[model samples]
Each structure stands twice: as C-alpha cells, then as structure tokens.
Target: MQKFSFNRRLVIIIVCLIVSFALMTVSVAVRNKRSTPPLIQQFGNDIVGLTDRIVALPANGLSGSVSSISELLNTYQENQQLKKQVGELAQTKVRDQTLAKENKQLKQQIKLNDSLTDYSAISAAVITRTPSSWQNQVVINKGSSAGVVKNMPVMSGSGLVGRVAEVNKTNSKVELITDNNDSANRFAVQITTKSGKTVNGVLSGFNANSGQITMNNITTKAKISKGDKVVTSGLGGVTPKGLYVGQVAKASGDDYGLSTKLYITPATDLSDLNIVTVAVTKQ
Candidate 1:
C-alpha cells in the first residue's frame, strides 16, 4: 500500500508541471498579438517623460538668460569703444581744419618771390624735426644745392625763425633762436623806443617756460618800454641787419643794477613753422 501511494504522488507532481508550462505559452502568445504595451508599463513611461521635462525647463531657461547677458555685456563694451574712436576722429578733423587755415594765412603773409632790402628769399617747406631737439632745430627741404649754407638766416611767414646749422645736398638743418645752449649764437638786436632812441642788447637765451627770449647787456639807463619794435643791428656780420626780431614785453635791471634785461616776444610763431624762407644775400 505504501508503494502505491508513492507512485500516485509522483504522477500528481508531473501534471502540475505540464499545467504551468501550458499557461506560460498562452501568456506569451496573448502579449505578442497586442498592439501596445500593458497599461501599467505605459503609465510608468509617461511618468518618466514628464519628470524629465519638468527638470529640464528651468535649466534651459537659465542657459538662455546667461547667453543673452553675455552678449549684452560684449555689445556695451564695443559701443563704448566705437564712441571713443568717433570722438577722437572728430577732434582730429577740427585740428586739421585749423592747421589748414593757418597754413593759408602764412603763405599769403610771406610774399613769395620778394626781396628784403639786400637779400633775396628762397621758399622752403619744413620737412622734419627731431623730438630730441625740437625746440632747437628743424630740417628744411632746401639744401646747399638750393643755395642754403651754414649760418644763413631762415625766416618764417612772420619773421626770423632760425639759421642754417647744417647743410646737405638735398636738405638742411636749421638752428632755431629758441636754443639755450652755452655755445648758442647771440643776435645783436636793437629796440626803437617811442622817442626814436635805439637801445641795443644781445639776445642770449630762451625762457622755455615763458616762450620768450632773454636779452641782456643793455645799458641800465636805456629808455626802453613795452611794445617797442626790435630788429637785428647788423653788428654780427653773419646775420643781416634790419630783420624784424620781436617786440619788447618787459624791461628790468639785472642784479646790482649794472645792466638791463629785456624779455622779447618773438615776431613769428616759432612753435609751429611750416613754410620758411632762406635769405641768400645777393652776391
């Protein structure tokens, strides 16, 4: 009887296994014939997509805001730079206009192709000036080939500017009267007082701060006053006589009252020289 019971239990176990296999096959076939996934799986996918959009919305907006702010800052900087350039361009234009007007007036005042008493003038343009000695020297387009020689007096549209310091085949260097060096040449200048008295002095140095030349060695008793016209005395054989030098601005006695010192405002605007004349004494 125990042996029969054992065989019956084994058969029951084999029937249960067959029933589980048949159910698994039927479930697989039903899933494959459906057009869409089960409802629970579809709901889970929708939840995942919604969560992704909700998380990315603020992040994308923040990225766009940052890009706009960066572009605005760059544009502001570029606009400021452009404004500065425009301002500079405007200033340059005004300066150029002023220079052109001055140049035209200077040319008219010079009276080209004219002679000054015993000397004939040669017109020349200022070619260059070195920064190292800008107040003391300038280079002219005229040279030895154009009858320019050392110690020859140079004049501007208004009056005397300098003298030829060095001469080359094509160009020459002019030593301005503003030079204050120890070895600088002096001009023998005379002033015509209001009463027609002539007061003589030596133009020795330049006061750079005042933009005036200093004249010394005048007699303390000379009757010199402001606005008196000064001219070359021709005492120095190199520079010709009767060249207009400047006007006396001030006159004062030196220390100990031994001699008089006169400050002269130059006849020409020596600072800005464009066209100049080389006075070549007629042979």
Candidate 2:
C-alpha cells in the first residue's frame, strides 16, 4: 500500500511538468503567429513574467555591490598616492632650508676675511665638541695640511674664540680661552682707558657662574675702569695685535687683597661656534 501511494504521487508530478511545458510551447507559437493566446497559454506567459521579475532583483543587487567595491578600491589607491606626494614635498623643504643656511654662513665668512686684512684667514667648520668635563675644547676640520699650527689664534664672527692646541694632518683641536688649565690659557690683554692710557693685564682665569673672565695680577695703582675696551697687547707672538677680547665689566681686589683683578665679558659667544677662521700670519 505504501509503494502504491508513492507511485501515485510521482505520476502526478510528471503530469504537471508536461502540462506546464506544453502550455509554454503553445504560448510561444500563438505569440509568433500574431494571434490572441488562449487562457492556458496566457497564464503561462504571466507566470514567466513574474519569475523574471523575481530573478532580476538579486541580479541588480549583485551589480550594485560590484560597483561599490570598485569605487572603494579606486579611493584607496588615490589616498596612497597623495601620501607619497606629501612625503616628497617634506623632503624637498628640508633640502632647501639646509642650502639656504649654508649660503648665509658662506657670505658671513667672506665678510670676516675682508675685515681682517692683516692676517690670512683659513676658514674651517667645527666638527665636534669635547664631551668631557672640560667643555672648552673643540675639534675643527683644518690641520697642518691647511697651515693650521699649534698656538694659532682662532676667531669667530664677533672676536677671538680659542687657540689651536694640537694639529694633525687633516684635523686640529682648539683650546678655548675658558680652559681651566692655567699654563695653556693665559693671554696678555690691554684695556684702553677713556683718557687714552692703556692698562695691561693677564687673562688667567674664568668665572663660570658669573660668565666673566678674570684679568688678574694688575698693579695696585693701575687705572682700569669698567666699560674699557680690552684687546690683545701683542706682547707674546702667540696672538697678533688688535684682536678684540672684551670689555672690562668690573674691577676689584684679588682674594688676598694684594693685587687688582678686572672681570671681562668675552666678545665672542663661546657656547655656540659653527664656523671659525684661523689667523695664519703671512710668511
């Protein structure tokens, strides 16, 4: 009985499919002949139209999704391109600024060379500074090959900075005037008074806290006053004449009260040095 029921259902399904196919065929034939379709054929045409409308909804949605994905990909590519352009622009700006700074330094060096007509100028760039407790030493890119020698005076834009302490073939070291080592740091300086009388003293020490250099060992009767222009006396041959040192900021007696001491503010900004000129006397 169960097998008989299954067979009956299968036959019913096959008969329904055959009837639907026949109705579609007749509908096509009638439409081609330009005749009105019968009732069954018209029903088949209506069913096909409804099925096409249902299928077209998902097809249209798929096409819209593909278009949105393509647009997103284009947007991502454009963003990446813009980022690359910005990076290139930043690099260009840095290069331009560096060139401008170097040009300004060169022009200043030319002016300094013209003013100091007495000494031959050998321009050198500062390579490094001393990292030890003695911060008064610097290395320059000039050496004996460029005629830089030991005890040669080094000057920046404002005034004297230091003296060449050691010279190699391609580099040299400068001992700044503020060096604590007494034997290598003394300078014979003269202060020009308002009355045209010159009072000479030795620059032997520096006060780091006060930012002043000490010109000590002066005679008790020396008439040194504040605001006097101090310059190299040219007594020793290490530094030449007329090189500006500083002005006398103050004057007082020594710690022992035996001699007078003049405090001077250095003309040059010793904390910052970029380029310097080595004064090499003409042979």
Candidate 3:
C-alpha cells in the first residue's frame, strides 16, 4: 500500500509542471499578437521610403556596394591573369618545337657526314674537352661495344687527327698527334712537299709552347731547312702514307750522335679537333 502511494504522488508533480509551462506559452503569444502588427507595418513603410530615395539618385549605397565591387574587380583580375598565362604557354610551346626541329636537322648533318666517311666510323658525340693545355685529346661517346679499339687511326675532313688510346663503355679517348705518346715514337715522314725541297726529317712531339717538332736521327748530309713539309711514310704500319704531319716550323740545335735536329709544326690543328672519325681496323 505505501509503494502505491509514493508512485501516485510523483505522477501528480510531473502533471503540474506540464500544465504551468503551457499556460506561460499562451500568455506570451497573446501579448505578441496584440503589439507586433503595428511594428511590422511601420518597418515596411520605412523600407519602401529608403528604396524610393535610392532609385531617385538622391541617396548613396557606397558602403553596401563596395564589397560587391571589390569582388567583381578580383574576378576580372583573375581572368586577365589566366589569359596572359595561356598566351605565354602557347609561345613557349612554339619555341620549344622550333628548337627541337633545328636540333634534329643538325644531327642529320652529322650522321650524313659520318656515312660518307672513308673509315669505319661510328657515330659519337664529344661530351667535353680539356682545358688550358692544347686539348690534344677528346672523349668520344663510343666504347668497346662500338668496335673502338686501341691504336685505331682517327681523322677528320682536313686531315688525320690522332689515334684511340683508351676505350670504355659509351666513351673513348682520342690522343691527338701533338700528345706525349705520339712524340715518343716519332715518325720520319715524307710529307706532300709544298713547304720546301729539303723536308725529309721525321717529326716527333715537342713542347707545345715551343710550337715545334723534334726530328731526331736526321742524316747530317741531308739538305734540311725551315718551313719544309713533313709527312708520314706509311712505314711502321702505324700511319698510312700522304697524311700531312706539319710544316717544318724551324731547324734548331747542332748535330746529335748520328742525326740532325729539324723542328716542324703539325698539319692538322690538334688544338681544335671537334668531330673525328676512327678506323676500327688497326692499320
């Protein structure tokens, strides 16, 4: 009986709270219904007056319109920037295509020249050259895979350049005629004698600054002079005949044990060998 009484009292309290809340809501609504219509009517009239004044051009909405104008100006600026970028991209693409075409044409020329060459020369590009010193040597873009071997004769259109000394994968080294190696094993060349009649001395490498050749073991009785031509004799099976070495730049020093000293210059410009052809077959 006591539990039933406690439950009934708790239910009564909840019912009372709900009834009070509903009465408060009804009182607020009745007050608003009586006072709100006049306020609404007055606000509508004031909005109409302001809009008419603005349309007549006697009032300014500067502050209200500035944000909209700023947004429009930003949009215009963005569109202009986009147009400029498109133009620049188009111009750059055209320039890139032109450069690519020109580069292809130049490579074709190099390939054609290589094809017509006498020696069995593979195509290669010179990546770099030495500095200061007479770049009597250059590194080519060929190696053992390309049939490049040691002591292969290398040449250009003007004349013989040098021989291959070192070969590696995708690269090879060309030692020019004026290098230290060629000087040691000097060739007593009989040149295409345009310089002079008394030009029958072997040419060897000399100090570059001296700008001369050391022709040793010259027969003392031979009539040798300055500005004479020196060329290969096709003798040692090293260099073939008719390849011009250098003009007899000058003759210097007294007679050695059994040879006279004849100084000479090389025919091919060793310092400036750009493109060269290498004969794979060692002659």
Clashes per prediction? 0, 0, 6
Better of 2 and 3 by TM-score: 2
- lDDT of model number 1: 0.75
Could you tell me how far off, in angstroms, the CA of residue 105 lies in candidate 2 after the best superposition? 34
How far out, in Å, is residue 142 in model 3? 3.2
lDDT of 1 by residue, 1-283 (tens): 9999999999999999999999767645543454333455445534543454455446656766988898887897899889989999999999989986776677679964323335778898765565785347876766666887677788897677787766655566688998775545677777889987887778888888899988877874658889998888766666667788888899888767888888999999988876899877654
Model 2 lDDT, residue 109, Cα: 78
RMSD of 2: 39.1
Residue-level error in angstroms, candidate 1, position 185? 1.3
Which candidate model has the greater lDDT, 1 or 2?
A: 2
Report model 3's TM-score to 2 decimal places: 0.46
Cα deviation at 137, candidate 2, in Å, is 0.8
lDDT tens digits by residue: candidate 2, 1-283: 9999999999999999999999877755553453234455445544543454466447656766988798897897888999999999899999989986776688697864422224678998776677887658887777676888777788898688888876665667788887876446577778878888878777887888887888888884657788888888766766677788888899899899988888999998888787899988644
Which residue pairs in candidate 3 collide? 183-205, 188-202, 189-231, 191-231, 245-267, 246-265
lDDT of 2: 0.75
Clashes of 1: 0
CA shift of 103, model 3, Å: 41
